[model samples]
Target: MKTMKTLLSASLALTALSGCQPETEKPNILFLLVDDMQSDAIAALGNKNVYTPNIDGLIAEGVTFTRTYTNGALCGALSMPSRAMLMTGRGVFEVQSDGMKIPECMVTLPEQLRANGYQTFATGKWHSDHASFNRSFAAGENIFFGGMHPYEKNGHCSPRLYHYDRTGQYKETSFIGEEFSSKMFADAAIEFLSTAAKAQNPFMAFVSFTSPHDPRNQLPDYGKKYKAKDIILPTNFLPQHPFDNGELAIRDEQILPPPRTGEQLQEELALYYGMVSEVDEQIGRVLNALNATGEREHTVIVFASDNGLAMGQNGLLGKQSLYEHSVGVPMLIIDPRSKKHGFKTDALCYLYDLYPTLCDIVGIEIPASVTGVSLKPLLEGTTDKLRDDIFLAYSNQQRALVKDDYKYIIYNVEGKITEQLFNLKKDPKEMANLADAMPQKAAAYKEMLIQRLKEQQDFCNIDTPLWWKDGHKITWDELINLYIFE
Candidate 1:
């Protein structure tokens, strides 16, 4: 029953009486990634104690952008270079090794939309590698491959998963999923949107959901009506991390233990907003299985999150600090042929610019070893500024820059250097540290964060004295064997 091929009601009434416009057909993309979701954890992006009615109904019907970021903190784990800069749109030192293996000369946005005929699929948390999730899906299933697991509260955790492997050599990946994990990734994306609504090409379905990051409990009682003394702390909550932001003991800032309080960061924000309202009720049952597989108006949905989680904010709880609650995330796109209904774009983008903005929304081409930069003219609004300055690195200690309205951090643990600027529109919770009262605007944002760390080819040496002694040094047994996945 694979359908979709219409237009003949007298050529749609002669293209609606010759007004033209009907050429669209290629829009099926449901990305919806999530993990550590933080851009003000929605309640229509203001965080009214987080209940996220399906991520506040995709921020009131998508187009949200709100300054999305992430291109920082590697090996200290920024989920394998933020899912390898979102499947190789490249950046954060050009996603090769920090993405934890994805260098067959990049091309991934689901292997270029599964070599352009679409149908690409992949389920839940694949922190890059497994031969780039076996050159990005062409059929996938309940998979999951690290960055967190051990959730067990009533959903009786089993974890350990994987299914699609056409010999990208995933080799007998122990399938186990007994619910939990946003209900086994919304039941493997509602069994791949009911066999991708009868399949006849057009499909992308990345899915991926690790859930509110951190096994923040709540498996079934769906957070017993959110109670941690009615959680509410973060006015830039702090009890530590005043300095030594040299990852003050990693593994996500030792998940609690610093002087941190206010009733222990309100019971870890009531188990991180009750695992973000049970991953927003399993993303409202995977958007009601894409509207019971009618393909939710030809898909093109993109909601994001690969980084952003510092549940305890400034006193950090990880996402290795570039703060705005660990690298401002949560983005959306929802193109049903945009006219920007719920639009919001503060546009200093980069989530590896959503793989050349989903290859400029399906017309495809985009790949010269991709380096991001395509929000598709801010999603057809034709322009809203893409960048003037935006850089952040989190390895050889730290470095940051966000030009207009200031925010210039810099630190270097070993050699003991430190500095911070922050005027993020009059201190957006950076709690005043105008770097010696704005030393020439913090040395012109440390020379635009050293020209944005040589235009994001970062290894971050910031004129080192010791800056992690020429970078990439790692060993706590190689950061626990680069986040165990075997």
Candidate 2:
């Protein structure tokens, strides 16, 4: 396979030493992406409650990026901008949010792969605008144009699934019936792999699954797999957020009535974990399909989520918050030919970095407009880290800067200003806010955040001192009342 020089050298050494023969052609890429999955939710990574044999298998067979974060969302529905950044390899401040429309000027990951003679195919959710989706994939099936829908329904429910012909036309299809989203997407991918067995050119299958997002529902047996009472609550779980972080009235936060109890949240967590396990079973089906086609050893499999979710952490039920449960996601890249298995790196990276990193892995030139850096060094065992600091922003209301072992967060909604700082090394859950205790360090991080925002051209009108001077008083009762509808 055509890969980075370092990877090529390492592969050659392994092949020579292990007496394994090298292929002369390019390898296939199976891009498996999920929606609204938390980083710590995977069974292999640390969570004991979730049963994810297939995902854990991938972790055992690949290199995992332990510390991967999304740049941030452009709206309350974090999936929109997060998918935009992922597809285009652009920063949060640079992409369009609605439908995650990729600009005409930019080249997407699939588009570049297609240009290089790879048969680019996609299935499942396509949250990006139709124009970009059409431009990226040569063929698509069982495509859900919208972001999310009710995962569980008692009656007959069939969300509209469309088929995108390579000729820029979409055809309505009933190919996807009442099957669960994960199973339906996996079925289509397995079928595609079976069909692709005869193709001469290499393929890039972009299998995107919308599971474990919301309407936390799995099959009856899968849902019953996890017990609500057995699921443990997050360490930072609370009945309500301490203050109004500006998204108190969002639809995700309104999933359940106020005064969320531990038992009820645990039940939701049980369903969420069930859905994760259900998706893992479907992933096993797709991997079996690849192996059945004899392409398992020649294919590169990547597993990641669009963004993360805050299922009960920090008293939030959605991804609108800046907490680790909301921003961090699990990422694994598996190269079947590589000898490195079960290797994990704690290198700081953004989700968009996958674009350039995959391009480098496959020896394809990265697009000019792509701003993400390639993690080829880390993959090739040449480096341990890619980035030291990460910048975050969401809808011009929240801003965060993570450097060293400390994370600084600033929230300005209306005329109120709130700052939070946490030593992530000590308190990864962000339970302690050191803003008032360490004022000088907080100010330094605030300045660093502002400077980083400037570098990203994110001029969101963050009037810090103005709000600091005006001193808008916000009480816990007032913040709680915001979520109470009239």
Candidate 3:
């Protein structure tokens, strides 16, 4: 009887131990970050001109954020700080930009994930400080590929040739610019994935693409894929932007002289679309590799851009102004563990939230210093509120606060404040600015902007630039050699 009782107790204990053992089935993460692709360029996001079938397919199999935003629109303006925010789960202002060093005290997303047993790897574009920030991954590569350069020559700084090892050390490599960089990064990522799969270790692969940014060069064959005459011009296309509205006049001067007649515009659009299509094709390649590795179903894929671009929107070619085309970005998160797939959320979520969201999806406790909230609840279709209001600001040009249906922009450079309250449900174009009609509502938004500015100023240690002073313009090479290399 005693032996039988002992045996029964042992069996019960084994059962209890089995139930208590933590689930070891962790999900792999694949993050695809595009440099300047706009939200409207993807077919899944209502873009009719360009077709991004693979990205759209990912959206159909996951959650797509309709109201996603980036921290800044311009490349140098917000890419570094915004990326820092996304990596650290903190706001740009919260990070101390002392010269070029990212403070050592902060616990970054990759570092945290590494602690949680994730084998992390990254490739392409680390526009932030030295390529060696802990925010990236344990083993990775970073290339400072944000500027414009000649397509055929290697004289200028190319986003493609730039590369760094995990410690942020620049690898000695020849500069070939975009095409080669994309291929190399993709190849490196595939190798990393293969290693992780063999080791049975969950991996976080961050693939940042530098194509479709500038000096727009497409593969010769890819460039030939589209005919210039077939391209369509945007409805908002204009010969010249009516007014500066406190915008940088330098970029305005760069506008290709008009009669930007149908022919020229179509040619430019064709090249742009061709570059985008090349990126889409590369994305499909990566996804196929994942499937071939038998990790497709267990992996979570995220597609997002740093910010949007204005190929021809609002008569702009870059992302400097405070416009929807510049601020909004495409953000899609796919979690196979969740029941809610192919869902759309219009909640105001920022790129900074991605750090915390990734942690949540992997069942890891987010560090206390992170300012962003977990988006899993929102992705799971459990939360109705993602953010009450999103604060948008540029270096010294514009500051705005966006609620559900209203957007208020304060042009600090020109000492002019403009408010546009759009019934997004009715007019998504934002053709009408209702500030003149609804003074009280505009005032409320202005107050919110003021509070946000104050908080940002306090945290960032930034003295708002005096608008009366003239701004300086530096050449691409000069800027890179001076500010970046120094």
Candidate 4:
């Protein structure tokens, strides 16, 4: 029998003889996740208004996915399911959004990496349950275990931080308002990378930032950098949403009431962009830390968001809708070993695909439960497209299918149904509804949507026309009243 070391040498020799690339050292992974960040918000991605020098620096060294989206959202709290899908490499419809828990049986990305001799660390917004966080990461710090924080009138508050002790018990530490959430999390991540520099095993660090989400309270310095009047409103912005989409009563929609003025939207945009810029600075700090530790070229960086936000798009102020602004998010990946930097692909992909893609990059076997396809081939320039089209769903209210340059959207709920179709290349804002002129295309897309639903085991009854029930067509007010708001 061959000795273990002799067998490894022989395997590598055989691989070299076959003209295959030899295995290299596994790279460290730094995954940066932001909340409610729209695809167009990044300055590097052509959003002329936002300032994101740090994120843009990564873009210069990475490949940007120009058309990535969240697979689905069961409710208005979209981040829960979005993060769940990201953690477990599962589809939105297949996970439990409530309690934000990942099944115990499932292997999370961090968990798998830890099992493969990588030290896993996490910090920042953990909207998912504590059990999943504790299970996935070997260590954590400055973690927020719940959803959005309460509004601070003076923009000051004492937030608590939590971390896992050696005994595995989570301990809480009181925090002062001096440091903002972004800085706190980034500081923790920088410290983690510094410590990881001394460790033999490579580290996998998840730095999740909760910013550009809500309360629009930008840091004073960052806020002063932008003027509201100079901010441009989205071209698709509407004073009010035309009809009820089953989520009209959600808290997110109430950010501004009907007849939203351009001034208010611009003001809000300034503050939101300010927060994004601040987050970009924090990212820069972390990157500088990576470089300081002499790990810059040996680490892989992934920057993405849990989901995108509307921010006054299509007469909406939230992510409950299926528009590009609401569902499409920025995904940037930088691998130092690859020569294909500053590349981009328009291929359709869900955020969950990152799990398998990272696994493929690190030479780990993807988990059996993972439904997302690896983008290694696409990233390596061996393929142009990983998928041809995409499907999006939000609650039982909205459905959309995107193929080529055409997007078909359906709003079905209660006793009303509406259809919309737009040639995205011609009308990226979805300003033109071609369902009437293109009935055949709409019918074909409806069939295609049904087929995708069946494949995903979504059993929503969408066959029947929802225009009339009990001898009356549903009114917008009635639909709004049906929602139970907190």
TM-score of 4: 0.88
Report lDDT (CA) for all predictions: 0.74, 0.78, 0.65, 0.78
TM-score of 2: 0.88
What stretches of model 2 exceed 4 Å from their correct place? 1-24, 150-157, 171-176, 217-224, 463-486
Lowest lDDT block of 10, candidate 2: 477-486
For candidate 4, list the clashing residue pairs, or say none: none
Residues 87-156, model 3: lDDT tens digits: 7777645654511334556677877776676766777766566543545465653344443335566412
Clashing pairs in model 2? none
- The number of clashing residue pairs in model 4 is 0
The C-alpha TM-scores of every prediction are: 0.35, 0.88, 0.83, 0.88
Better of 1 and 2 by lDDT: 2
| Candidate 3 segments whose C-alpha is farther than 4 A from its true place | 1-24, 73-77, 98-101, 141-167, 171-179, 250-263, 414-421, 458-486
User: What would you estimate as the lDDT of candidate 4?
Assistant: 0.78
Of candidate 4, the 10-residue stretch with the lowest lDDT total is: 7-16
Q: Candidate 2 lDDT, tens digit per residue, 1-486?
A: 222233223322332343323322778999999988999999899997888888999999999998899998756767877887888888887775432567678788998887776777788888777788878876656677777864453211355566554455555343444566777678778877876655666788999988877766435244227889999898888887889998888888888754688998998898888788878888889999999999898899999998888888888888888888888989999987778899998888998999999898888799998999898788778675578799988765788998989999998877678999999999999999999999999999988887887788774545455433243433333332222111
Window of ten residues with lowest summed lDDT in model 1: 1-10
